[model samples]
Target chain A: MRSRADVVVIGGGIVGLSTAYHLAKLGADVVVLEKGYVGSGSTFRCASGIRAQFTDEANVKLMKYSVKRWKELSDELGYDVGFVQTGYLFLATTEDEADVFRRTVKLHRRLGLGTRIIDMDEAREIVPILNTEPFILGQWNPEDGKASPFKSTFAFLMRAREMGVEVHEYTPVTAILVENGEVMGVKAGDRTIKADAVLNATNAWAPLVNEMAGLDRELIPIKPFKHQLVKTEPIKPGLVNPLVSPPSWNDSYIIQDAEDGGVIGGAGVEHGPTYDVTPTYDFLREVVRWMTRIAPPLKYVHIIRQWAGFYAKTPDSNPVMGEIKYVNGLYIAAGFSGHGFMMAPGVSEAMADLIMKGRTKVPLDWEWYDPHRFERGELRTSAFQIG
Target chain B: MQMRAPKGVMVLGQTDGEDPRENIIICRCNEVTQKDVEDLIDRGITDIEEIKRLLRIGMGPCQGRTCIPLVMGIIARKTGRRMEDIKVPATRVPIRPVPAGVLVGELDEE
Candidate 1:
């Protein structure tokens, strides 16, 4: 690796590689450091669903912008990221939950998103096999979609390398070298690479990296939570085009990949915060129970694999972006909770703008994702978090 | 009745097939040819999981039972790495393919 660089970004997932690509496009020298191979972290384990049907206005706007970028990403990178606009469906089983959907639909419509509250008939039209007995209403957004996380992450990495960005795999940063309250660089093994700026893009490991920089955990409280998912053997393609979310069934979500015909699904289980990524038998049983309840045909399918990953959760379930005020030349783009894969495109563009020009051009409410929100007591309502 | 060859095995004295080596199928379920596996290896993707995700090599009903060892051998030959150095894909639950109906307590009607 080079002994010096203009900027060093930590992490090699979608966020880190996309940020490196954007930074290089803006004429900034960039270097990306990863503890493992690219996309081996949370990016590979993500469900890969993208949507703009969020309750929060800022989140909706950000996702809408991200969807636009995702549509054009394949052409821009000259590699197919497997982005398909198969739509996202959210089901509500009670009147209270339906009321929340109504409010969210209003907010989504106001933000220029093509989301609407659909009746049972319209919901059945979208997904014919859906069990209508469980849900009273549904939220549908046709613009929302899914992409292949491996393709997307590698697309960014390959393009970033072509644009003069240096990426080093298996190079773990041992310590953040801070001198006289200013960011110097990082020490990896026996070598020290001095950089003008350092960005902490390591999602689940952000808190640990921040502590290495001598920042208090209370300043940026990021906790890791383990979530598991399962993939069934290939059924028939296009069986389930849209991502199906049944909020009453432990927040279960299901989607079928068009390329492989495999039905991928998962559900949230109550567990304490930890970094352990061991998949549990209890999770498989719970998720399968809810999945088979929604669609009986899935009961005949065979599960092929199950794995777990971490979500770098914040207090309000939004990301923490922008520069750190306590330390000069130190920036961070982390705490995405579980939505990092969907939000990577827009977040990278906005982060690049913030780093080079001290502001973002995207029309997002930046204050909602301020890194110091917990300290300022200005935490907004958590976005409608689901699989 | 004539006995047909297995899904991925090549029959001897078959001269009608064109480019016999490249046409050889490695993943019978996914129809992934030797060319497909070699092209990805040529592009510097040696990781078994990445290859599986990109090409759907081991995602079929057999769950890598028929193709993983063959693909690992090809990777070892192309990258000049020892077979032991190549990491194997992680094995998951339901070692034998168990239908989801069995997990949810659904039995066949008598």
Candidate 2:
């Protein structure tokens, strides 16, 4: 890239580009290095589900803030992100899950989220295609919605570039140069761009980037696990309103993509700590079974595309944000556990505040996501994470 | 050198037919023409995975079954790299569209 810049962001996905946009807005010269094209990482494989429903107060607050930003992101980016406010419906299969969901709903409402524990009838009404048999209880939040990944991410990338940010596609950050525990520059491709600040936005590749800066032990529990999402061919739209999910956390998510008429969702797996992002036949079968049950109409809609991408999962299935304790001028906005695509705006803005000032407007204890949390066994887990 | 066989019919730079197939639609599922793929290659998307994502070439209903050979041939010729060296992304299973009944059977195994 350029011989010098104020900050070098490693990764051109939504998180990286959003951080670049926020950093540029803060009057910092930024260069983004992406080995692949923008929106081609975990972003491309997203089902585009956005929700404010979480069991933990930190996540609930973070998602509430994220939802507020997403509602107005279209206007800010000057492009239609296809932000269809289809709401989010969580189906609880067992009595225990129903009890947990009810408690979670109360907590969410107290946190200023319009979440409620609803009956199966309401769930079916929201998404008429839902079978409503296996679900004993459902949680509905009309404020949550979905957005198009490619369009929204490209919007951030374009806006960042327009704001004097240098984004180099096909230029991967090979190494992060640190001197005296302070940031220096990054070796991207062949050129070394000097940076007083460096952001490790490389979610799945966090280990590799941190190792370059001699901070490998900080994120020892972070690993990239493959998740597969499938899409059906253009079906008649409006069949499903809210994104639907089964109680079996990972294996159940079904929502409509407003941009294209295809209904998109995923088949979740438990085995991980592997970087293999290969789509398996197993996922297709599981997805079909779980999704069709939630929305029976999916049985007829033929799947058009199947793809897999990485989820940079931390040990607690939550994100690791903020700066490394030992490295000055080095910040982390990685390990989002597949929620990165939906929460990019909030995370990016918070990271920008953390880098520019020592604090963030995000009211939650953003420091809880510190990379060193694992070493101290101070991990905070989010109870609900729909793959 | 991973000696993987070409996945589809090589048609990008093939000169066998009298009418130039260069302008023809190779990925019928996604309506990706030869020119569309070549332009992506010109922009340095020589890798098959990038070409699929950017141009939507091999990401359609038929997957890459109809377009891989045409793309691989063009990439090899353009980049001066041997076919073995050209890395194509993984070809996932469920190659044929399975009926709902077969899918249920797979779920039952779990």
Candidate 3:
């Protein structure tokens, strides 16, 4: 069986669904294909941490717009993305680190962001259990918060459908159809999908999809890195806001879920040779050590469950966005390195605008994130290096 | 976690201070066997990848959520497989199970 659509999205993740939703709003016939359940990829396993405290101006602007969209997503999608305004508290345990925080805060404030640097005492007041003895200053942004990645992705899927987007879950793309060195569509199972435009938003599996399309693409610089986060058994809430560790170490950040009392925390773990998402004892031990060091209250709290997720990393640790140069009708929106969940809303919306209206109004510089940047020796370094 | 041992499978681990011969298993996700794992190397399924394929040690719905560590310990018992050889599997999203029906319901097909 052969099908035709105005646009065929290669993956049914949050980014793909959001793009479909926006494209359909512009009256385009969109079809989304999924290899697994919707939100089952990186979307469901995401930490769902949204913030505008980024060091890079482009990232800060992307997040700033995304935070706004998130605030009203419930009304837009008719389902809560679980946007909590609990705020993000990034602490600086040393004076030199404090200087960095101050510089970041200045940039943030200059951009009209409500981020401010506060003393350790103020930091302790925000998150009561934070041990300020090791910190001299902190960055506070009351607008930053965590959300339910599952619910958000699901909401986008539902809303996209309501806007007339077709989604096929468990339907893997067996191959991408290209003719005369241009993408024509995709082949899923025995069915051939003829598409006018194809968007690849497969996240960690972008490389595989690109290969299936037979494009001479070198996403060769992109690889997967494993990261693990755990939730402790429900206990008395020790912290009111998210606590980002001083200088971003293995125990990068920990925050209490506002909807569920479970504490959500992340630890940095290295990638193995093969694609392995299994949890590790090393991560558990290091996370515990840092968690206890920063917040003594977590020492006795037993971990209830832990899961690992892969951050699709590029050579520069930044996303590879924009259209592929050789693939005439193919667009690339993958490689978000651990920050996909937060960046999806804005990136997807931007891609949708660029595809439908031929331009994007968002502050995102599509040129900087071009898929051909690596070949041209251009790389954008990510500011946040920790988990 | 309570695990009923599958047929022809021997229970492994501390046994929670209970009888080791009882019909109870350590990892519940994949019905792996202590004896099956022990015989893995002799059966030519020596490495972690081979063990994972032979006995379904790390291929369950949880994707070795509870059992990978146990399998790692069993592999660690053998001095041949280095500590670094027991690397963790790649973590995909939707950590917990979600209804496939919900995903299907999201699409607006003709």
Off by over 4 Å in 1: B1-21, B108-110
- Writing each residue's lDDT as its tens digit, candidate 3 over A110-164 gives 8879999888887878878778887777888989877777667767877887777
Give the worst 10-residue stretch by lDDT in candidate 1 chain A.
A269-278
* lDDT tens per residue, model 2, A1-387: 478888889888889999899989999999999987777677877778888787888878887888888888889977656677788888888898888888888888789988888898877777767788888988889998888786777678768888999988878888888899899999975789998889988888888888888975445567888888877766677777678887575557888876556788776664467777767878877888877777776766666667788878888888888888788998888888888987888888888888887788876466666777888888686546784
Q: Give the CAPRI class of candidate 2.
A: incorrect
Candidate 3 collision pairs? A45-B94, A276-B89, A276-B90, A277-B89, A277-B90, A277-B91, A278-B89
- State residue B105's C-alpha deviation in candidate 3, in Å: 48
Please give, for every candidate in the order listed, the TM-score of chain B alone compared with the true chain B. 0.75, 0.66, 0.62
- TM-score for each prediction? 0.93, 0.84, 0.77
Q: Could you tell me the lDDT of residue A64 within candidate 1?
A: 93
Q: Which candidate is the best by lDDT?
A: 1
**Cα error, candidate 2, residue A137 (Å):** 2.5
What's the ranking of the predictions by lDDT, best on top? 1, 2, 3
Pairs of residues at least 3 apart in sequence or in different chains that clash in candidate 2: none
- Say which prediction, candidate 2 or candidate 3, comes out ahead on lDDT: 2
Candidates arranged by DockQ, highest first? 1, 2, 3
lDDT of 1 by residue, A358-381 (tens): 887776567788899899877778
In candidate 3, which residue ranges exceed 4 Å CA deviation? Answer: A217-220, A237-240, B1-110
Interface RMSD score of each model:
1.7, 3.8, 17.6
